[model samples]
Target: MVLQGLTVLNQKNYEISQSIGKNLFDNINEGGFDYVISECQTCKWQIDMSSNVTCIHPLTLLCMSMDA
Candidate 1:
């Protein structure tokens, strides 16, 4: 699956990909807005605000592991 972007915040405004569908939806539904956003190449994670824009790389969001 090709992942392009992810919105980890709002329901009315946010969006999630089918690749990360369950985890993303679960997080939003369960109020788990906190997430790690990163570029595809580096795989370097960063803590970001839910309002921020996240760009996903090809085959991105293969898995989203949550700590909280």
Candidate 2:
């Protein structure tokens, strides 16, 4: 499943962000998706840093699959 536009709260709300991040990660794992693609760089970074799932840009996926 593709999750987009995820935003991390500022430093003052770090704990809140961690809780939300954990929930997001847990949901993604439960969904059994192969990839999580997002156009937002922050979303990509967050997913990459927090989970084992492959997170990529939509354009990257399009370019890679062009020959297929």
Candidate 3:
């Protein structure tokens, strides 16, 4: 799904995905966790290419033109 020119795929907002995108959504150290997280515990990923505008679609303002 597209959001503000970024392809963010969240379950409540995406068309082909299902997730909240984060684990332990609260401050667990303060008191306790509000809910359980069941995703992979050892998975490490990165978006080095999309760190800038490299992954933005052509329909986005950054990819659009002033005269067109």
Choose the strongest candidate by lDDT.
Answer: 2
Reference-based lDDT, each prediction: 0.38, 0.73, 0.26
User: CA lDDT of 47 in candidate 2?
Assistant: 81
Cα RMSD (Å) between model 3 and the true structure?
Answer: 15.5
| Clash tally, candidates in order | 0, 0, 0
Which of the two, 2 or 3, has more lDDT? 2
Residue pairs with backbone overlap in model 2: none
Question: What lDDT, from 0 to 1, does candidate 2 have?
Answer: 0.73
Order of candidate numbers by TM-score, starting with the best: 2, 1, 3
C-alpha lDDT of candidate 3 relative to the true structure: 0.26
Which 10 residues in a row give candidate 1 its minimum summed lDDT? 42-51
Q: After superposing candidate 3, which stretches have Cα over 4 Å from the reference?
A: 1-26, 43-68
In candidate 3 the C-alpha lDDT for residue 52 amounts to 18
Best-fitting candidate, scored by TM-score: 2
lDDT of 2 by residue, 1-68 (tens): 33333436366655566676787888776778888888888778878777878889999889989968
lDDT (Cα, tens digit) per residue for candidate 3, span 7-53: 33333444321132222112223334332222222211111112211
